[model samples]
Structure formats: structure tokens, C-alpha cells
Target: MRVRRLKWAEEFLGSAEVVVQSPQDIKGNWNTYMNRECIHLEIGSGKGDYWIKMSDMYPDIGWIGMERNESVAAYAVKKSEEAKENRKFIQNEAMHLLDYFDKEIDAIHLNFSDPWPKKRTTKRRLSHGNFTSIYKQILKDDGELHMKTDNSALFEYSVVNILKEGFSIEELCVDFRRETHDEDAISEYEQKFMNKGNPIYRAVFKKVKEEN
Candidate 1:
């Protein structure tokens, strides 16, 4: 379903200090804004639930939430403001991630990303080989890529593509809610699906440093 564009989204987002209208402006200086050394980024961060909560849960690590839709990005920004957190929000597409971030990111999170179920659109999936290559470029040598989704097909596809990209699967869970750890904070969509008795799949892929 298409999100209804909020008439005041642009104006509201413009006034939000947490929102970065042009991510490229910050580029490699993301940590400078949050005043932290380690930074973690979340792609397709819907309504900022996970990132915001995680930011509070881990005060030492910086957080950045990237979302393309202005309407939804606005809500994420609002949540950040309400929490009095300095977490950053990028109002841009994930495809152009390199333009906004450098190789300083310590980790990347993909929470409930679009499955892109069509065969022809498989390459558009966030965990596709092409996208994984892009992620490898920005992520540090030991950086981790964590992903969660309720769509079984996407989870399986992600595991295949991640392995093909030379990433080692550190952890895997076909049913996240039942197997989640104490530190894991549930996102809004995740909680909603879990309430409906749907199983959530999760994986942690780490880039394997090539032996010189």
C-alpha cells in the first residue's frame, strides 16, 4: 500500500533538528553530529521505533535512520525529538547510501525491508548481491549486517546472497520472537506481526576479511 503523502511533511521535517534533508552534506562526519565514535545505520527505518529505542538502550553508540518516504521519515524524526535523542534521520533512498556514508560505519541493520517478491525485481531486494556489494563497500572490515523479516522467501534469499557475497552467517533464527535475546528490542512492525502469531526470521552476517 502506498503511503498517503502528508501535506505538512516537508515543512514539519524541515523544522526537525534530527532530520538531515541532504545526507551527503554530512558524508563522513556522521559521528561528529552524535558526538560518538561508533555509528550504526538502519536502512528503511520505519517510524524510527527500533533505532530510537536502541539509541536509548545503547547510549554510547550513534544511530542513523535512513528512510526514503518523507511522510514516514517525518514520523521517525518526530519520535526522535519526543525522546529527546540526537539520533539522525536521512531522508533519502537507500540505493544512494554511498553518497551519504563513508567506510566508517560499524554496523548496518535491515529491519523488515521490502521483499521485492517479483522474479524480475529480485535484484532490487536489500539483500541482493548488488546491494550487498554496496553494503560491503561502506561497512568496516569487521562490520556486521543484521537483518530481520517476516517474509520467509526474502530471508532465504538474503542468506543465499549474503553467503555468495563472502559474508559469514554468525547467527540465524527462523522464529525470532521465540528465540530473541534479552538485548533485542522489537520494532513496531515486528511487534505487530508477532502479536498476530507470525514468525520472524533474523540473521547476522559478518564480512569475512580476505586473507592477504
Candidate 2:
């Protein structure tokens, strides 16, 4: 269902507008949110649950949650307004990633991105090298891509893709739930799957050097 135009939300976001329309606009005057040169991104943020918590936890850094769906995006916007000073939610797709971020992003988060199980639809996966390449273009030299998922097949494919794409896989775990995950902020789907004892897979890929 579509959400009504929230006047409060519009005012809240307009007051703390950090979103950019193109990569070209990312540079210059970035100290609007935090004095430090750092930014974090969460792709496919479903309900802004994790985003709200993270923004509350980390005040010195900026958080941007991107969700293409309008209703879902509104949900994030509502949460962001509650902590309007540090977090922002964008209603858009991940394909336009470069448009919103600059080269100073400290980290990128891909929490349970679409599996895209079929071989033919592999390119659509966020973990695909093509997306990774785009991510590298806007990420800082030593930035990290933190990813988590419960899909085993997709996890395996991501590992292969990251390696083939020439990125260094610093940390990887087949079952994130087996061990106590401290930074685990439960997402809308994560809570539902936790009851089933689903094993969540995770990996942190760091861009070591430019790919030729």
C-alpha cells in the first residue's frame, strides 16, 4: 500500500537532507552530518530497524538506508526522523548507487540482498562483481563491504564472485547464528528466520587493489 505524504517526514528529511542525485555532487562540503570524513550505506533496508539502531549507536558517522519501495521507504523515513540528526533514508534502487555516495564512504552494508538463485539472473544479485565494481568506484581506498545472508547457495556464489573480482575476503562465516553475533541487528526477515534456527552466512570483502 502507498503511504500518504507525511508532512512531518518531509520537513524532517528536508531539514537534514544529505542525499545527492549524482556522483558528481558527492564531493565538497561533506561535513554537514559529521565533522569526520565517514559515511555508511545499507542497501535494501526493509523497515529501517537496523538503520535506526545503528544511527543511534554511531553518532559520529552518517548512515544512509536505500529502499526502492515507497511504503517500505516511508517506514525507514519514519524511523530516521526519530533520530533525524544522524540517519537518512532514500527511496530508490541500488543500481544508482554512485549517484548518492562519494569516495569517502567508510563502509557498505548488504544485509540479506536478493539471492537471485537462478544462474541466468546472477547479474541482478547485489554481490555480483558488477555491483562490486561500482561499489569500488565510490568507496574509499581501504573501505569494507560487509555482507550477511541466510542463503547458502547465494553465499557460495558471493564468495566466488568476490575472489574472481579480485577483492580480499577478510572474514567469512558459514553460520553466523551458531556463534553469538554482537553487531547483529535483527532485520524484518531475520527475526522470522531465527525461530527456525536458520544458519546465516556472512563475509567482509575489502578492496585491496584496483581490478584490471
Candidate 3:
């Protein structure tokens, strides 16, 4: 599908590197436009609107969003320029997150990722162990992964999968909107789901230290 070009997306083009190669393009050294510490990553950041808002809200933390779709990534990169102090968008696949980020991220966010509901397509689900293993590689010790979903089956599967991957759940909410959730950021998909009367599930899991 051809993505509609947003007027704001044109400004940041070519100013940043378009990371086609996985982890190879992610530089550990801080640049004048990038942040060196307290970095956070978001996978499947469709248009990056939510993360852009987050970057504005939190000035001290660096934010990066991974979106394979060029058009969507463009939108994110454009908006990031508004709060260019510490935010970036990578045009890469979710499966290659570890390739682009080292073990430096403080947190990772997954918002309404592909459910891959079919029995035969389970491996494609973002919450599967394979993806979590990749997340573990790029996450710092004690790093947190925040996930939200509207699919009940996928949410249940994620709880089991994350546990199998040695992560401990710190928080889980089946009804986030009604629960005592802080006035947190909401993704575009999240708002759409809420309009349809669907409930959202939220969870935070910490990476367990690997014992030799």
C-alpha cells in the first residue's frame, strides 16, 4: 500500500542515516544529534506518533522506534526532528532489533504488535520466544519491556512465552483503561480499539540475569 506522505515528514529526510543494515548501522558512540545514555526502543512503531510525544514529554531519555515500512518510518523521523534533542527512527524489521541496538536500552515497548493468530503462523507473533530472545540480547540487565495488546489470545500466549524465556512479570493488567493506569501515552491503534469497545491488556516484564 502506498502510504500518504505527511507534510511534516519531508524535513528530516537525508539528515539521518537510513539504516537498512541491521545492528551494523547503530553506533554506540554518541553523536551531536543522538543520546548516549538511558535509551529506549519501540518495536513496530507504525507512524511513530506516540514515541514522538514521549520524546517531548521525557527530555532526558533517548527514544528510538523501529519500523520496516519506509513511509511510516518517515513520519516518525520527521516528527522526531521537532524534539531532535534525543530521538531517532530506524527503518528496520522488528526481528532485527538486536542488530541495531546493543545492550544499552533501558526499556522496550511493544504496542499492539501483529497477533499472527493462525495456528500455523505462531512464529510470526512478536511475543514469541524467538523475538524475546532477541530482545534479551539488546536489553541491559534489569531492562523492562512494556507490552500492550487488544487480542486476548495473544496476550495470554505472551505471558506464557515470556515466562518460558526467563523473564519475570512485574506488572500485568487485563483491563488497562479502567485500571488505575497513570495517564500514559496511547498509540493510534490503541485509541481505535478503545472506540470499538475492546479492552486493552498491559504488562511489564523484567529481564532475568543469566547465571553461568
| Strongest candidate by lDDT | 1
lDDT of 3 by residue, 1-212 (tens): 14886565445444565332335655444232364468878888887767877777777887777887767778766555553657766776777665566777789888888888899999988888888999898888999998999999999999999989989999999889985544468767788999898989989999999999
Q: Write the per-residue lDDT of candidate 2 for residues 67-140, one digit (tens) a residue.
A: 77655666677656554556766667788877656676778888888788998999989888778887887778
For model 2, where is the 10-residue window of minimal lDDT? 15-24
Higher-ranked by TM-score: 1 or 2 = 1
**What are the models' TM-scores?**
0.92, 0.83, 0.85
TM-score of 3: 0.85
RMSD of each: 1.8, 3.6, 3.4
Note the clash tally of each candidate: 0, 0, 2
Off by over 4 Å in 1: 83-86
Instruction: Locate the minimum summed-lDDT window of 10 residues in model 1.
Output: 79-88
- TM-score winner between candidates 1 and 3: 1
Number of clashing residue pairs, candidate 2? 0
Error of 3 at 169 (Å): 0.4
User: By TM-score, how accurate is candidate 2?
Assistant: 0.83
Q: Which stretches of candidate 2 lie over 4 Å from their true place?
A: 1-24, 27-34
The TM-score of predicted model 1 comes to: 0.92
